[model samples]
Target: MDSIFHEKQEGSLCAQHCLNNLLQGEYFTPVDLSSIAQQLDEEERIRMAEGGVGSEEYRTFLQQPSGNMDDSGFFSIQVISNALRVWGLELILFNKTKLSDGSGGFLH
Candidate 1:
């Protein structure tokens, strides 16, 4: 790469900036991430409804704010993961992996 790609932090869009920086390009926008967040929200809603639309838990869940994202541009980890999925990539937690030798190989 000729130069490092740096996307300045804008508002509470740290997740969006982090994702673009990881991909080393301007490959995502707030709109893109928001769309992903919305889709996730819908999926969660459907799952909650599976327990019965009139159930108290489902109604309570509907009243709660979206866990996937917020109006202030903050997005949950799930949103970021889903965004990366579009490029056929997966997000693995560094501290969650172990090598055959029983060491934290993912950190390396």
Candidate 2:
């Protein structure tokens, strides 16, 4: 299948492809990263499947902080810690605030 590389967001490329297939207006199921990687060469595969860009493991890891937890602190302590770690690595953390405004402008 044809694929394109875009900026990172919440899901892996496999995840996004699974999502995008659904966004074409159908139901989606999880994808196997290995299957997706098989379609690309090593560098493209790595670009597509990196922990931050194509982070299957990281996506599963994200649910704990945002989903299940006890005592607000029990939840938040780990969440803040992870955020700090991502921020500490400037490259891995994307600035999600930038948006394109309809009035002929971009917000940065």
Top candidate by TM-score:
1
lDDT of each: 0.90, 0.35
Total clashes, candidate 2? 0
Give the local distance difference test score of model 1.
Answer: 0.90
Looking at model 2, the pairs that clash are: none
Off by over 4 Å in 2: 1-28, 32-34, 41-108
Candidate with top lDDT is 1
Q: How close is every model to the real structure, measured as TM-score?
A: 0.86, 0.17
**Superposing every Cα of model 1 onto the true structure, what RMSD results?**
3.4
The residue-by-residue lDDT of candidate 1 on 27-105, one tens digit each, is 9998999899999999999999999999999999999999988999999998998999989998875665577766676
Model 1 TM-score, all chains together: 0.86
Residue 87 lDDT, candidate 2, scale 0-100? 33
The worst-scoring run of ten residues by lDDT in candidate 1 lies at 99-108
In order of listing, the candidates' clash counts read: 0, 0
